[model samples]
Target: MTVMMMKVFHVLLLLNSVWTLTGGERGVSCHFGKICVFPCKFSPGDNILIHWHLTPGNVQVHSFYDNQDQLGQQDQQFKGRTSLFLDQISEGNASLKLTGVKVQDKGTYQCYTSTMEQEAKTSNINVNVKAPVQKINMRQTENLIICSSDGIYPEPHLSWSTSPPSNRTFQNQTTVQKTEELLYNINSSLTLSDREDELEYNCTINTLSDQRRASWRRRPSVEIISGEATISCSSPDTPLSGFSLVWRFNQRQMIVTKNEDDEQRVSEEWKQHVKEVSESGRLTLQHLSADHEGTYTCEVSKDGDSSITQVSLRSDPGKGNSHVVIGIVITLVVIAAVIGLVVWRRRRGSKCTKSQKVKKRENNKLEKSEDNQDEEEETKMNSS
Candidate 1:
């Protein structure tokens, strides 16, 4: 009897080793701060038991017994964040649902379950948590181009590349900061070459789960000489089959919008300025004056990804020259008026001097005549 009992014990040990080595292993992924469900199953029976533990430390994540949750020894880190499907437990579903998942929650989990008349079963689940990279913003100020993104996890990476690839190495700076929520924010800037030739810049943010890219090409301000201009949404060679395009002026006013159906809508306020939209999404603007001198942004969106191109507009140099010419003409008119007033004053003064001299001469002649008359009267009186 002792020999038989030892043989049965050895058989049980071998069976246990096999189960430990070949337990169901799978991977599950969930986003950070979201719910994650760890799949598990067992045979249906009376008085079911389920327990979930973190591997390596065997930390208790959740437990179920007596047809209810038994969390007396649950880990503090997982308290109030772990749950089981109570309604689905009797059907042999031993899945554990975790809420508000954190970065530290990424690990291997062990789900153990048992029943009154069935052997205990174990499953290993590898959990992966991710915070995907979102909207990347790219802008340029003179020769400096900046790109940034916020609220990403797993420490995103930033890289810069240029189109029409240049041989000259670019100088760039990058920084990463942690937010209060423990997510990452990345920023990078690139100093472009002094050459004014057209070049396209691309900024990319990469993570284990997702990647986002933004492309921009700085264009010199357009000087409209003919009171009209045509601004292309993208390169003439780019395909616009499944894309939607939007044209905005100064970032607020919507100038025109085109959808995938090839329908174009122009804002009422921009009707006079927007002349036509071509099949390739080129915008022809008419009657462009000083009021139209600002930034015009073209956004192309397809499948949730967007590419933006910006063009700055300015009134014709001749328009500005007209202002300068008007100022010069006004100054010349003022100077001419001043010189004409001085000449008229000098002529009037000379005329007044000549008139005074003529009056003096006439007075001298009258005085001489009066004196001769007085002498004649005296002589006549003496003769009488």
Candidate 2:
């Protein structure tokens, strides 16, 4: 058993906590408070030493030698508590065994080799503990569905989808909340036209199970729109994949753009002047602004959902509006800056002013010389 006793804890920088380098000692894995065993991945004739030291509080842990008979072990904190599984050492498996584990062991651990040809190699291992997700909930309001879920492990992902996979019409809201490590929740709403018939809702949470990820779905049928800006959230009957998404502006219907860029720009423009879409196939106009001050149309169909919104700037001639006043203000600022610059340059020093004047005079002289040359060329041409 090789235990290096130091005044402070010291962990090796290795690539793997459990691997073997071509010329170094092997790797190892051991838990806290229990008997941790490791193998030295090296031949019997190898001239090397195996050592272990933990540094949560600066303490020399342990060490062992291969060819030479050397002994410089640590204090009693790690007497019978540490050792190596020597049987596999000659095979180049340098694994360390720890008899006891402390909370201070909750940091990066490594296994390394410093022999010839193998160069330097190590391994780093990060250990963590997590829980599980056990519950999910979803509620519907108007044309939007607020999805809430909890009791998840390994951080669950939240998404809105179709229950039957028809890819029907719907919008996603942006309000979300994370309540716990294993729990999360978000709320999204869709807009529906008074003409729409049905809407289905889906909320999915993804988490880990047996080191594998599993997806859990929570779906609920929601209400249909009976008025403006309202949407329905319910599953459709014929598996909605074929249904076209519809959009409307104010009360006018519009067409959905097939090109992706056009759709994205349209959506961006919509957010600027309108509400986003909800899973219920209804487009929402978040807040009314002067930018939102125009005739809008919502278009819905079987292919996709889109909207065309107009905007009008309300003008008040009596009291100059912000846009006009801002321009005047900017013009005044520029004028002031120019005046300040002129005054500063002119008053800074007579030497600078004189230099500028000389430069200008030289430029004028050059122009006169060029002009005279051109005139003389013309006269010479006439004489010829």
Candidate 3:
């Protein structure tokens, strides 16, 4: 009986050792580009050694011995990125903190602890790193609107919404592509309606039961070059909502109009210059001269609701104004030169006239002296 009891005690010790070696079964979830901690604890003592290793790769992530961290053989991948709770080391806490955790960190980690009095003990933890999904793009291409998102994990769900509320669901097609890194790239497309007014389209991507979601809204915008500017009007979304859009020049006369009934009308004079009027209510003029430069009004009306936007096209007048300034400067320069010449000539003429008068007076004085001398000579001759 004593021998049998001893054998049973040995069997229990073996089972306990096996259980310790196996470590824990539950895993931890972490996000990429975040911090992860592998928890460990022991009784306070000296001559302690705690080492952490990444399994499968057998990489030594971190180690501590003689009351100090020893990284002479640390893994190159985890260099300068792993640390321990140094303050709590004396209290037997050997938790490992990893900074800037990456997708490669998704694996099993082993924390082995040894002391002078106790044998080595090992604990295991599994980490699952999740890559976040951001950067959703919405673009309009011709008659189709496409929405896409890339680099997402654990799959993502997509949904769409429109403003001004409509019961009709857009016929959308979604495609998901998986990358080599186990991430997903998703795209959704929908055909637009030939509508005049703008409609707001919203695309949303939801992850893991809506715990996280990202949405993007499409806003209509118009951009035209400076010279021969094209006055094209657009709503938030088209080929989805049919409404009437009208183009008015200087807010006075209607230059063009695209009705919801697929009818487009252009003014008689505008026909000569209208280059292309699209079904989407975009009016492009061939040559945008000064007559076309003014406040252009885009009026949209649908179901008793109307929106008007005025776009002022002011001619640059940059080169033209520069030329005018040069002409004015030249005229002023000529006028100044003419006035200076006239003043200089008048001053010269006055000085010449004054000098001539003085010369005439001197000549008259000489003639009087000659006549007086002749009379004196005659009197002397008479005396002789």
Each prediction's RMSD to truth: 7.5, 29.2, 18.7
lDDT of each: 0.82, 0.43, 0.70
TM-scores for candidates 1 onward, in order: 0.68, 0.26, 0.46
Candidate 1 residue runs with Cα over 4 Å from true position: 1-22, 71-76, 223-229, 237-239, 244-279, 284-289, 303-305, 317-384
Candidate 2 lDDT, 68-108, residue by residue in tens: 31235564665666566667555566666665544334443
Regarding lDDT, does 1 or 2 come out ahead? 1
Residue 58 local lDDT, model 3: 65
lDDT of candidate 1 vs native? Answer: 0.82
Per-prediction tally of clashes: 0, 79, 7
User: Runs in model 2 with CA error above 4 Å?
Assistant: 1-40, 43-48, 52-86, 96-108, 113-156, 164-200, 206-384
Worst window of 10 by summed lDDT in candidate 1? 6-15
TM-score of 2: 0.26
Which candidate gets the maximum lDDT versus the true structure?
A: 1
Error of 2 at 281 (Å): 32
Q: Rate residue 169 of model 2 by lDDT.
A: 56
Q: Give the per-residue lDDT of model 3 (tens digit) for 283-366.
A: 676655556666676766665344455455655565424556688899999999999999999999999999999999999999
